[model samples]
Target: MDRTLTTATTAKIADAATAGSAHAVGLAEWLTRRAARAPHKPALTCNGITWNYGELIERIERMSAVLAAGGVTPGARVGYLGLNDPMFVVVLFATARIGAICVPLNFRLSGQELAFIIGDAGVHTLVVGEEHIAVIDAVRTDLACHCFIHRGGAVPGWESADALMAGARAERSLPVAVPVRADDVAVIMYTSGTTGHPKGAMLTHGNFWANNLNEMFLWDMVSTDVTLNFAPMFHVGGLLCGSMATLLAGGHLMLQRAFDAEAVLHAVAAHRITVSFAVPAMLLFISQHAAFEAADLSSLRLIAVGGAPMPEPLLRLYGARNIPVHQGYGMTETASMITFLHPDRSSDKLGSSGTPPLMTEIKLIDASGEPVTAPGATGEICVRGANVMPGYWNRPEATQASFTPDGWFRSGDIGYRDAEGFLYVCDRIKDMVISGGENIYPAEVESVLYDHPDIAEVAVIGAPDARWGERVVAVVAPCPGKSITLEGLHAFAEGKLARYKLPKELRIVDALPRNSTGKVLKATLRVHNVATATGSP
Candidate 1:
């Protein structure tokens, strides 16, 4: 019983990992507990189907037996390269039941991009979707995935997931051999590679348990609550936090394959979903969607956002609509949200990323490791918690450099904390654009540019320049039937930002390039060889 901590206080209890010997404990256990307590309770709802606790556990058990019969073993890397699905949950629990580590691959990644992650994670058994089956087949020669379980529909070199489940037993029929430990790696979520190739963040069982416990403390969760989690299952924010967080409360998860605003709104109303989590970009899409005004989104109690920042305008819009939106902050290393914007401070603290999660200890430190005491003094955001990942998978040097000597995981984000402890992110260390010896943050510029009437979407990137080292350029998608001159945009931004911070060049387009999750893919944009001189500075 956690003899590591001598205290029995509630605060210490808040940090305690769930009672378990191993980290990679099967979802079967969690399901069994809830089923025993309330068998009829809906555990998951998706695509016009609702699965109760007992039923979900039975499916997971069948899937686990299927995987075990297919030669899956302890420590085996089972990769789920698919979008969000109820089947993903089955795969997740089934992988854990046999003591295997689940590697959920992002479907949005290109074949080459996915190949790197597959090789890096040593994923030999890939359970992909029909959409990614061709990509997997194309890159199968180089990747380690020998056995593939294809969902969605049938494809060659892939066994049907439904067929496997049909043939397998619906109970834990195999003899227990390897024990699931609380510290064993449960998931290896690849970080969103904004800068380079994605690195696997090895999240142990304690990481998830801690995250779940911290979530209960920071947010209101109950067994009666139904969560409409539209976020992709491949991401830690979705799989670990969004999905698992709902499970921890013995609540229901309404699964959607992807974030379709009208669909999500329908699900929330249809399923009576009490909670929802999404990225800032998703929130923007939902708010901007044509059916926003007509949709009944009132069933949503707490709508949490993270992954990226939303401007204050969006916050006001959500608040006006009766959905209290709280912005959360974390990385793959923290399992999900090491910090979340509290409901109370959602409106009171505008542009703030809220407080650290109950189990987390956060500090802002400079290059010298000295703490920044001032409110506006931007420093690196470092987090220490049970929720924090042990290290990167198979990269000791990268892991060692990722933390301080004392155990804080160094987040490469520049942010400041207020006296009340709310965080205000300034910029990413890697994303900071330098022009003519001047420092500029794309977020700051982007936030200001977002306020303009003509702009639909805007991305500020550092363009390669032989003279200024890197010039600031704004690539924007304008609203339909509306246009803004490059000089006019400069004139609008000039007062809000410094001269170097203002976009020296403005390029209008039909649409801005975005990642699979709708995040502006700046790296891809930087390689865009389009240059047009509008009436600019």
Candidate 2:
């Protein structure tokens, strides 16, 4: 049977599912519908436990009851801090069930950072895993959250989620799912905020629904497909990119607490996983694993990759194994993916980020705000779509500055379209380095250095220079048993890159600093470089 769903077929399925419903767009409704249709089907698996659709929905309903009983009403903010687990998914649906907004906190953030977000969102109730309870405790006095619920074993002052859920089930009084409009806010996802404090992006139920439709149009997702999701669920790439889409399609989702390259290989083979999502760094680690060549990965039909471009070497490695890696472009503000390069065209397009999804529109605009119509003419990428967030939560000025007067959401990334309309992302507007009188994109420079045998990982950043205003600096994590020097790097790239684009300095490190989602922290690197240069502690 053909698994690919056409746009009209997917729309019909959605319409039929919600024909008479007033609150059809609420995300929790999707689980309810799926459970009614396929109660016995495996829906989620984590840490050797599997929950079918029926059991999953029951858990969500009970959790919803517990939250409502604890004073979480419509429009309230509920924060969740934990590793990737079925509970995270449950809390998201449970919060949405009662017309509350889910705030997924990054597990890797410091206590201070987490406190800022919890306070900013004015979270009424916060759910956390036992491992993270201490972090929350450190900042408990600073937060306004009234209720603390623990996911695992009991804590001193926190309510036990397991016990509350048991009590809720015994009561047999499931609260009726609240009605929500399509544009009603369902989640307040905070950005990474490399420059300043993170801003919460208010994503509506319709934004997620539109993203799911876009994924269904691009991927051959089916009920039988088993998906492995090990990326951090706090990020858009991990949650909406493939995990939620799989659940919506009635597919099995195998969750991992965190990414372990060897374990990922074993799970794919043991479970015959068919679909997954990861960043390029995860793919590189998987490819470099000792068992990669021998692992049985034939069951994987699609591996949706975002966060960064997949290096050519990794793409070829996966290609030889017959596993397709689809590259996509998106951010927290865009729900998940705006553009997806089909695997069939991966080779031809090479570095392109594919075309906009079915319900999204993308354009490029010059610095003067005029359309950049000619192919290969680089400009700031812009997007206009239902999937786009309405605005940053409670920050009207920031939201206004992020969009054009006509309503297109400015992406802040520099890119250009080929004649075929495929987007080639150059670099972020802020990351672009201007030296003397010329413009340079660090991504372009990093792409070249990535091919060097001695470089295991590299990030190109600009450092202040006396003569040129700014100079290119290559920060490299050398391959094991290898070392690199500025002279050697220049020699290797002499012919490949322009003289001005070549790195003016080299800094060797054991590993590059990265966020949980595997994006190199260039801002951190720049700050560290400045401190070292100035001999600051």
Candidate 3:
């Protein structure tokens, strides 16, 4: 009854199987190995439908076969435009199975922005949800694609994924001929660039797997843990930290189309979810929900929050409610959580993003490019680890500028690590706002305001808000000899910036406070914007 392969035998088997096949360090193999070890374990559960490890692996293989049959090949960019669903997870693994890069598009992006990412990635086949069929149709001419697959239902000339998946035979794919290495690019996630465009960050399979292992190591997760993932799949935090981590751990994942506080709480109680990921906004809603006092949330063993800082009030609420949430910090360039504050320390640290994960190295560097070696110190945060992305797609200048000579990623955010290794972020080098837990780069907003004719000069900054965390505030200098009002400025930006980035308080003045050298000082505006807006003439 000894069915176990010895260590040497296992190594030999792996060497023989992966001899010429691409994806040597791939998650496809990970799924198979985990399935063989525990086939009955649940891998995904969405809207009451469940798939075990065995079933999940089979679906991935079949889907990959369908993709390959449809002409997807190694290095091809396959785009996915949908909300979070099991199919999104399936598409990720399927694309990786063949060494193709997965491009996850934001569902909320305008058709023009979506076109840029799809075109930038050179994606030829897009898999979108039926909800976006109209949106995709509007921009299909701009998408440099050959075909499309609809996730929810059928569309004209586009294959229906749900139907195809239902009819597709479940069988493991024949081994790929060439091995996909750890360094091979697995995904391309688009980040809003400084130049009013989006840049695709090329992340390898190793990047995704390494981050998963780091989180797994930090939390010491077990098979019994169930993670509820309501974050958007297109983002690194959602696909990697939320869903991918669950699959990598061979645990259970509960999927959501998007973050809905009531739905999230219901899923937790219904599935008895033990682990979960949420941003500060989602956590705040849960804290303020009517069910907060009634719902038995004791099933949650661990939680991680990111995309914004966890305010002191919210952190205290979770601690008092017996649901401690670890704060994590990272960006699209770094595969999800670069550093994590474990749940146990959620209450203790109060405001830190915890220490770097096991495989990651974090350093603080002064403006002179020298490392700051102690606590209560502030400097630009630099990270080096397997979880770091390979580079941006087709952006050599950006890739070169983003790193130090030695290889550490130079994060523009300023933070300091305590003696105990907890990271405390103070300010960002880039003028960005984390209003309602979403990144709002001021440059993007400023560009929107620059188009207004009445505005001679304008600057936007994040101002404190009691309810919304941070609200975008814009200050404008009226053109000389021309008259303009705050209401007029708000009307110009109403349709331009996203609702969250829309200026909450607008100030029209004779001149925006600027430095002597002619640089608009944002630091000065943050204070003056509040003072001047009190009584506008």
Q: Which candidate ranks first by TM-score, i.e. highest?
A: 3
Local distance difference test, each candidate: 0.74, 0.84, 0.77
Q: For model 1, how does the per-residue alpha-carbon lDDT over 1-537 read when each residue is reduced to its tens digit? A: 111212222222232234443333435455445555555578887877887765666666667777777778888889998777888998887788778889988776667667888898887578887877887787788876667788755666679888877666443353243456677787898764433345788888778878887877766688878888877788766776557878878898888887787887777777777888876667777777788888888788888777666567778888888887767877778887767786577777777888887888889999899998797788999999888999988878889989999989998888998888788877667676655333356776787789999899888888755444467888888899998777788788664554556787887777887778988778777777644645333
* Stretches of candidate 3 exceeding 4 Å from the true structure: 1-24, 166-178, 480-499, 530-537
Once superposed on the true structure, which residue ranges of model 1 sit more than 4 Å away at CA?
A: 1-28, 152-154, 171-178, 192-195, 432-537
- Candidate 2, residue 81: the lDDT equals 95
Report the C-alpha displacement of residue 218, candidate 2, in angstroms. 0.2
Compare candidates 2 and 3 on TM-score and give the better one: 3
- Name the 10 consecutive residues with the lowest summed lDDT in model 2: 528-537
Q: Ten residues in a row with the worst lDDT in model 3?
A: 1-10
Q: What clash count goes with each model?
A: 5, 0, 11
Q: Using Cα atoms with residue i matched to residue i, what is each candidate's TM-score against the true structure?
A: 0.77, 0.80, 0.90
lDDT of 2 by residue, 414-460 (tens): 99999989999976766766554234668767877899998999988
- TM-score order of candidates, best first? 3, 2, 1
- Model 3 gets an lDDT of 0.77
Q: What is the lDDT of residue 456 in candidate 2?
A: 98
Q: Give all candidate RMSDs, comma-separated.
A: 11.9, 11.5, 4.9
* Tens digits of per-residue lDDT for model 3, 1-537: 112233432343345444444443576666656555566678788877888766666666667776776788899989998888888888888888777888998887767667878888899678988888887898787776976999766567789876766555443333352347888898999887776667899898888878888888876777778988988888777877756767767788888878888888888898898888877877888778888778878998778888887888887777777886778998889988678887777767877888888878889999989999888889999999998987899999999989998899988899988888789888889777777666677787788789988779888788776656787777778677776566676677664544665677776667777788988888987765334573121
> What is the C-alpha local distance difference test score of candidate 2?
0.84
